[model samples]
Target: MLSTALAAPAAAAAPRYQRYVALGDSYAAVGTLTKVRSAPIGCARATDNYPSGVAARLAPATFVDISCGGAETPDLTTPQEVPLGVNPAQFSALTPDTDLVTVSIGGNDVGFGEIVRKCAELSFGDPFGAPCRAHYTAGGTDVLAARIAELAPKITAVVDGITARSPNATVVVVGYLRILPPRWGCWPLVPFAIGDVAYFDGVQRSLNATIGGRAEAAGARFVNPGLTTGHDVCQLPGKKWVEGLVPTSLSMPVHPNARGQAHVAGLVAAALSQ
Candidate 1:
């Protein structure tokens, strides 16, 4: 009986999810989707985001979510000032004892916001003429490609920092969700030229490839979501994981919605299990 009692205590001592930290930009930050309430202030974090979803599924002992909107690679090391409050450097949330870490970043670093904005603005002139693509490649140089190349080193640095800060943590880098439809885009909903849709999709693919490659090289697991099959923003309202340019719900255009968050959380959980 004494031996049985001692063994029970030993089993109970096994650590579960001791600590988890999520970091990144709007994609990582969960926000309102179809009027669903989440974090009320800075970062617009939603309670139903992948971090939160993972926590619920894994029941981590401790979880901290510092993801913010408009975050760049530098924001991982520097403070970010948002309307609700100032978000500390994302890496600040990490410690050697951190058990798990997940980040979905780098899009903003590649000037995605500017690209989208420019695309939207140029769409008005010629909805079917690929004006956005022409504008970006006006000088026969792909500016966006240059931006991605510039950010590659930064992403590597981030992965190195996370490894340095939490040497034992299971670091998972999440990739961006698909934003364009397969084959054909919903012109009225996304407003991008037919050619521009393919162009943008190619850019996203490039970003994902870079992120996946960097994460693998840094000894971290990468979750690609593999959502491109049929879960693009142009999918039917309920089928889409990412919202279109003109959101059908309260979700921000080009961002993931609740379903998307849940889907990513599942992917993260699966990765952890492996």
Candidate 2:
């Protein structure tokens, strides 16, 4: 009889959770910082953006940034109105096997930009304050309750859907970075009433709260930069992450700049590591 050698069992490979996908709006897109490329895989699409920053540190196998400028919650699940060069297609890359996913949205849905634009032009000279609070609470035209109510469920659905699609993936919902000081008396730079600044901040805070609550319910992570509130664009030059009303350039208004993006990415990486 010939002696036969038994074959050794094969070694199991390490679990691979290296794919990272980023989904969100102009804040995440960093449209103003760089030109967007048609390439599906490369940081040619706003390489300086926060998600890109995170990926650079993590170095995942695949980094899919389906983030579009001006994308809202509904835009993630359905086709949306498209402006030139902006992608409106809903994100479909995230699946049950996806490794990691992060989103930064809901600002457009609540028309927060409009508030800032309007407030940026307000004059509080005579009254020592702008009509910011009145404009927000008048309940007929400028009140945001309806918009907030509508946004709550829509954003919740997006988070829940993402969780269902990527049960094992680490879903992280990032909150909006601050855009103004807590009191907003930046004068010509911000050019808004202190009350208006407070109102805008309140809106942002409320939106972040909703996002945190929803993400918690979906068993995902919610990262808020609430601690960085006073360090917004209205702050002195070196202290701000976002730009003021009159931007240093034609980039996204009141959004996080490169420094801001770095801070955001650092926070996100820390969260994912945990």
Candidate 3:
């Protein structure tokens, strides 16, 4: 009886999952040059993306990462057009047997890239003031925040879809890392206007909060990209997890570098183990 009872507990303590699938946008794809070129060319799956790190650490029997650049929530269910190919629906990877799913999406859905472009363009004319914030909040309403609210439901739907398709899966939603300092950081280095730095920083935090809440509400766990506060683009090459406009490291402008990917990988793995 003792041996039989011990077996039950021991089996239960084994790895919680054998099959794992990762879904997300560019932020989740952050890392160095390609080591695993399994994803499409434009999908930009780095050799050291957090998903790969998680998979390696967990040693799952099977793992799939379909994260792509420029992907939105809708792309989770539909194909996304890349430069020379099409990334199949991320949901296609999920099956009844899938027991772990991680997602880090929603920035593009909220028009973040456009906002950054517009903000950068506006900064040239008013480098000393909050031109980007003024432009976004021009009509007495914050359009960026409004967009986040409108797209919030789609994120919830993504979690729901994952649950319905992979009922046994542990869905974990990962939030974006902080790209800027809390206050007005080194402006020209990052290209954000002096006064608009804090404003845009707040916007990022708000987006993370919205996604984290929606994911939790939709029955998935949340993992904030914590411990990245001081590692934003403004920092030097060796210290920064994200690179600035003129990258001093091997990462796209304003994207996470190798160190960032590795750090967040540890964070995700820790979250899963807990």
Among the numbered candidates, top lDDT falls to: 3
Ranking of all candidate structures by their TM-score, best first: 3, 1, 2
Per-residue lDDT for 1-274 in model 3, tens only?
5687766654435555789999999888757754535458788888688898888899788889889878999899999998778999999999999999999999999987888789889888998999999998987999988998987898899999999999999999998888889887786767789888899888998898999899999999998883358999888879988878788876777788888888888898898778
Clashing pairs for model 1 are 30-46
What is the alpha-carbon lDDT of model 3 when measured against the actual structure?
Answer: 0.86
Show model 2 residue runs off by greater than 4 Å: 1-16, 38-45, 85-88, 124-127, 139-142
The alpha-carbon deviation from the true structure for residue 33 of candidate 1, after best TM-score superposition, in angstroms, is 5.1
Give RMSD to native, each candidate. Answer: 2.6, 5.0, 3.5
The residue-by-residue lDDT of candidate 2 on 211-269, one tens digit each, is 78877786779888655766787676666788776666435567777778778999988
Model 3 clash pairs are: none
Q: Order candidates by lDDT, high to low.
A: 3, 1, 2
Model 1, range 110-181, lDDT digits (tens) per residue? Answer: 988888888878877888778887988888999888888887887788889999999989889999888786
- How much is 66 displaced in model 2, in angstroms? 0.6
CA lDDT scores, all candidates in order: 0.83, 0.73, 0.86
Best prediction by TM-score: 3
Segments of candidate 3 deviating more than 4 angstroms = 1-15, 34-39
Model 1 gets an lDDT of 0.83
Q: Which candidate, 2 or 3, has the higher lDDT? A: 3
Q: Weakest 10 consecutive residues, lDDT, candidate 3?
A: 7-16
